[model samples]
Target: MPELEVSYKTTSKQFLGRVTTSKESADFIRGLFNEGEIELQEQFIVLYLNQANKIIGYYKHSKGSINATVADIRIVLGTALKCLATSIVVSHNHPSGNLHPSAADKVLTENLKQSAALMNIKLLDHVIITKDGQTSFADEGLLGIKTYDQHTAFVQKVTEALEQKTKHNKLSLEKLAQTFGITDKTEVKELTELAIIKTARILAHSAGNVKERFDKIVELYHAQVNLSHRTSQSILLQQYSTPAPIGYLAGIFCEVDKLKEKGGYAFEPSAGNGLLTIAGEPERFYVNELDNFRNQNLKTQGFANVWNRDATQAFFDVQGNFNAVITNPPFGTAEKKVMYDTYSIKPLEHVMALRALDCMAQDGKAAIIIGGHTNWDDKGRIQAGKNRIFFNYLYSRYHVCDVININGAKLYSRQGTSFDVRLILINGRKLKPEGAASLFNPLKDVEVKTFDELFNRVMDAMDAVTNNTFMKPTNTLEREAIELQKLFTTTELISRFDNPPPQEGLGEALNPPYQPACESSVVLNTQVPDSMAFETRTAIQSIKEAVGGDIDNFVRHRLKYPNK
Candidate 1:
């Protein structure tokens, strides 16, 4: 019997119609043969399809010859049973250049066809693929009419696999940490295989190359770990100081570093881990450090004369001025940081406010990273509206930029450092609100070659998001609560004609006089993407995956509307 030349032929029914639709099926088939054996004949394929005839699985089984014609049904269908294949397509390759089907190949197909039918399993297609192309005995009228539909629909196998993997972006650190008994998000001092595997699976689903995704996951993890330790802890825990939010701090520092490189003086008051004190920061800026150990660390790192004085008094006695002073000032009051009374052990607000003022020269610029918790008061209004008060205090002489939400962390979480941070740039010389607008530019392009710049940019974006005024949840959030009586204005419909549905249902229920509530509902993805949308579908997907489903819908939804 002459070796049957392999042919391109697949039917809708075989592989549950999945193989027929696959564009990369040819490559996948090639890979299957190459999996173990040295050549093509060593492997055969069994494509599994669902009830709907869509391929749910594409399986590779058994080794035969290296050259032409190397597979059998017994090797293929038997493996399909293990995966619970509803229907299967069995295919073999002929390494020989010619694709003529042999009498033996005919006899073998017949036997498998009869047996599969008897076993209540459908024999959808018998495809023969060769070096040049494929052939279907069924199409040539060599196969009986019954198997015609089965042989014509095989899709591209590799395409299906790639698409399935990339369809949903996912992450693995959470799964591995749970599996390894590493409960704390911060305690992960080292990474394990499971974590790496999880990362691979996740990155396999992103917009960029696989390498970029893995790098990002690692960077995001390192960042979150650094942020997780930054706050209130049990006394014993507090004994060891908390680390700064690594990702956010580094980014803020980089900007100051850039300014310094250009010959501007930069100063840091609370430099932890010196996340921002890079080689590029200004040459003559002063850093007032209260911690003796950290100060020494800086000094050793060439930060000359790291002052071991309180920042409050240090600033009061400062002799020279800085071109820029950027810092992540401590926010909460409970911790016994180097504190001084402005009028009385100063408010955390007053501390940051004063730090900004003191740090600036007449024409100097300052950027500060402040915790949003400090943005409002106990009443849930912007703490004392101090965001404004601080702005006004600084604005008297300097122009204020919009608060930049760095990486989107409202508060550092024990779960991870992959949150947001906001940086507000205030120019020293008094000017209009728009004067510092350029500092708050949203990155239009992403070039993430090294993990550093990419990591910093992502954090910077998060910062912009967190500090966005739209964060307050409503246009008139401060307008006053919607009184029950205000549902219908007094002059118009008093006894009430139909008002809108509940705001909760506003998302699903809104009919278009208004479009679908894409703007109002922050968590839901836009059903139809628009050109103007700030958040890309991939980015939104990334956000959902990063925060887990734990973050509130507001955070999720607002993320989609980056403009807000």
Candidate 2:
């Protein structure tokens, strides 16, 4: 048998050495993609680099339709091993010319990074190339990709170390953390180990010794830590409080203007830092806040009627009712009940809605921001099915007008947070209307951008979706309910209650009309989440224990034997 020798080759004569900058690396990748026919179809390629980042070669991993391309993990890593490269850069072109990485693209980059790390190969960056420009994963700090630092001192140290020859020892995590003020021990330790291991492998592939690689590794950790710090700085100043975006406030006010009576006092129950307070009519605005810092901040800012109290307490303490009430109240079960109990409804925003009605003057108007799922059933039905009861209750009580839905992320997202589900903005008059509640809407003429644009877009979306009633049911709840009903009806104990027995050997039969033991219909109609139901049942159990009898059994027995 003849033996076949495996050999590696460099396909390109262009010796692009030392991938210094993201722009430079991006340009090289762009050039590689440009070599082929630039068409609408997406093509994925991986650039294999040596310790110095000189062009070792590249492999075209996958080519697919205009909208999709596949970069198999096995092939990507296999190509790197074949080339014997120390580092790699994965890239793909978008015919759509959109540079923003889709969620799928981000996931792919993450997978590639983890898979490559196991093989001791550093994935430097994942670049998305378009005709206009490139979006570098390293630049955006996506998937923990390190953005290289070109500090003169660090560069000099690396250059000097490379000129010498010595085995280098890795730096300790504690030393790196202390030097950089990194409190995230876990992240720092992970990066420290990864950088050290990758640097050693890279040095083995080039003229650079372990000592030179160690210097580069230290520099890498510093850049990564600095990037994390910078990202932290971009967070909203009051993220802990979930400060509403300015655009949302603007949109609310634009719609509020239609209902606000001139010279009427405006009140914000859960005011934080007086954002909504300042947004309202200056002379007529009043605020109440429980947060000490925010309350002090409002007072320091010279707000005239800033009450340092719980909103529900303020509702009782204040002398006169407000003409216009608006707020995005906090949402927590404990604090919500503490502010004002809404029986089993634990969401603070819902209690706020009820409180607003109580505190507002006759014929007064109110606008409130609430959680989106308030009117959603377990089946994912919106404004109908089980949730219909909740809306019906609202319609019957207040002159419910409009319900605007917006992404809750916008409120706290200046800090780079994003929520998948939308929140709700409810507007209404305290007085009952003559006919059906006419849901109000925001106008579509305005342009929303940046932090401010989110609110207007929310308003626009709410307005647009008003006529698109009936959210498709996920059917999860329907299936759950049917199963539950079957379980309840067929259970041995429940079956005993269904067919009541003769009363204690007295020969008299006892029978009563069947009444559900726990008001299951009411619970479902209101769309109570499972947690709330559990808490309520626990409370009921406690009461039953205190009374020294099983309440559920009594109710069941009573329902069947009322005529005993």
Candidate 3:
């Protein structure tokens, strides 16, 4: 077993002189500092006084630059307690000869008072000393501490009285402040303005017309004793935040003609305030929004078939088919795998595309906007691998009608960050299961410098689709042509065509143009020339490393395509 001991001691000395009033306190504080010390820089000092108002001990808490010095409330309270002080007086000097108490001075005095009270110590005064004179927060009655609840209630009562009277017959703000026991002019104005703004926002939601709402809000403000309101006002304000520019919405709707008919059932799976769905104005529309506030907004706007639920869950259980589905789902969210077990589609954009397909009519079409990672490169060429698996799957199932690259400026709100935007247009008709999908560069012919230009090109394309004059899907044929053209344009092909080998030692004189199938150790056949043997061996070594050595099989490939 171990033994423990505790000890206590008091080494502080006693002090004697009483400081009852603000002037006597200020004079004692001023007398402590010499004229030379006061002229150097700003300094904060605390004077610990006893129950009889006698000075016990004093501490210079901080020394700062010519303009200001920092004083920590903790240091002040600790020093008072250490010195056995019952009351304390704090002071600081301003080198600029100004004796007015700053806004920070008033706040600091209130905080010190509150903290000292907690320790069972009284705060006598806070004085600002200057070259000219001194000012005391105690003398001005600014040191009286009031709780936040008391101030807020007073302001609300005054605001209610003002709302009940006409503009010409209203009570003066100064008189109202005096009646409410609030002395500071700045606080009176600030609290009044805050109360007025609170009323305006609540009434803004109740009525539509400007003058009518203002009049009605005044009537309600006067009749009510208290108003229940949202603690966080920004939540209501952010509901009005614009998600995307109207021009981008217009551009999406420009493809209306591409649908099986001009008008039919439409749906927005991730409807945020129903902006796109409401703007598109399909004959019949449905919406799904995860946010409860936005769902209520959609309902207030006369959208009845709105489902406030997670998109993934709601989409999984969706009942009816949509003729046209348009959506811009949340990006950068983790998507869980459901319904399809074979495919490992993880990105939210890719998952939304697959889910959108599930709820579409057999002949339905869709326009989707995806994030930057799928569409852009530094050199501005289509890198084509980010969403290659998803795109290939689409081509295998449905016809990918068009692809467009929307400039960042046209896709987001004015205050939003710039990002790369990609749109994919799909035709609901299914393709044969056996063949691969074709890829084409539709953006090559379209000018997307401005929203208008982009919208016009989409409209023209939709017109062609509706008139049955759309371009045929020759994507596979175009890709084959491009490959053959590249082969003919190679430098090695040109060199081989211009020069021929001697027929006498045809096999021995000619170096194999292609790589070998294997690179296992073996002696070279002496019949082959030295110059051609070095190049042939090197090519064979590379091929064997890549495909595992099959020498005879590699030779047959070279013979099959002699020029290549």
Candidate 4:
């Protein structure tokens, strides 16, 4: 009998296409399905791609009943290996017209992702398709992974540039001081400060306006840092910066922009790069950030005063001076407990809130984002422990106006974690004796499961409140909040996959075409091509030896430097 021969062939003379976004991937996959079968039966399809994300081919893995399908991981990996594909996008169509992934869908996706990693293949995204629309696991952050993209790349580049400039300026300043034989520490410090200011101005001008520059710098801090190191640091410090939408919402409640227009003073305790202050657009603002890097960033933004002291100390000299205080303070307990008179407020968020209140003028308004659990449980009842003491203290002393519960999953998806947060809008003025007595009786918290639910509860609370000049009119505030919600939701949903609008003169380089270093060619008679055979063999050997049989490291190495 003749030896059996296996060969790979392609019908197309050119590449099918390259997919960069979840929407594009969905569209390409949808076009491959049989229109008649798509609505009648569930089908699992996988698209194999080269390192550049250019589609190599697609395989219909399995087909089953209307609502479910069985997908074999071996078959999927086998096809990818045959195609020499580096990445895969798995998608399935739902006959029920629901874009949401079922429990089984999520399980299958996780399994496939892990399996692909073992084989040195990237599972880029898992999409659910319906006639109406598509849902991407990557876009929704369901994959529980972070992939490097243009935004991260840009931030990394900016960080490198900044570091180089800083080093050069420092060396030059030292050389100048040596040449002049100058030993005055104050003079050297002043000169260094001037250099930093000049460098910041240059970066600010190149990046764009205050908001744009602030965002870029924040991204630089998050992206350029090592993930594990940063995670450890963050946990120790309880440092989670406010998302832009949350910052804007806090600003709206605090009326930051209006205060800015009136030349009112604002204070932000535990300001992370002054994002909250930027949202308020306050002309006169004082900020305190414990992190040295973040404090330097605040200075770069040209804030009136950027203090690097413990915020619990309450800016003693400037106490009772601020018109507005807007902040998202560090959550969890402080390393050293803070005392409120004889009472101990162990929760760092509460300490910061109390400090903010102290820093505010008698009529100052504040919107503080704190851990939601501090006020109520999931069932809307007050929680036990230190929370009760903190709430009682707050209600008995300050004018507690309204609390808006924000869904952390929707807000912090990019950060790859979720927790509930509450934005408490407060007045610095002490509550009237009768009002304080009534509020201190018992706390009635509203149970909220969704954004809409929490929004309605907030609106109702606003309606019940009387004679509060800090809050805008009910109709106006409602309309503005609704608009902001719409904008925020739209921005979050589409931001993951959408390409930034092209800038003038940058042209195609802004969104470069996918180009693989080694062109994929047909394999015949189980023979590997000489061009890729050496690299492939070496990569496999390196994976087996150096990485202890971990394919993920090898695959990432190849993808990072494709030409090698």
Q: How far is candidate 2 from the true structure (C-alpha RMSD, Å)?
A: 26.4
Expressed as tens digits, the lDDT of each residue in 57-147 for candidate 3 is: 7788899998878999987887777667767889998888788888888888889999999998877678888755788776666778443
lDDT of 1 by residue, 392-494 (tens): 3443335444454433332334223433345555545543232101111123222233335544544554465457532334322111222112322433423
- Model 4, backbone clash pairs (residues 3+ apart or across chains), number: 0
Point out where model 2 deviates above 4 Å.
Answer: 1-261, 317-320, 335-344, 372-392, 409-411, 415-564
Candidate 4: lDDT over CA atoms? 0.61
- The prediction achieving the highest lDDT against the true structure is 4
Go through the candidates in order and give each one's C-alpha lDDT.
Answer: 0.44, 0.50, 0.55, 0.61
Question: Ranking under lDDT, best-scoring first?
Answer: 4, 3, 2, 1
Per-model RMSD to reference: 28.8, 26.4, 25.4, 36.9
Alpha-carbon shift of residue 142 in model 3 (angstroms):
38
User: How close is every model to the real structure, measured as TM-score?
Assistant: 0.34, 0.33, 0.42, 0.41
Cα deviation of 390, candidate 1, in Å = 2.9
TM-score of 2: 0.33
Tens-place lDDT per residue, model 2, 100-198, is: 999999999988889899998888788888866888887677857334422211332333343343223234334434443344543343333223223
For residue 427, give model 4's deviation from the true position in Å: 2.7
Which scores greater on lDDT, model 1 or model 4? 4
Model 4: CA > 4 A from native: 1-229, 374-381, 431-564
- Scored against the true structure, residue 294 in model 3 reaches a CA lDDT of 51
- Residue 519's lDDT within candidate 1 is 39
Which residue pairs in model 4 clash with each other? none
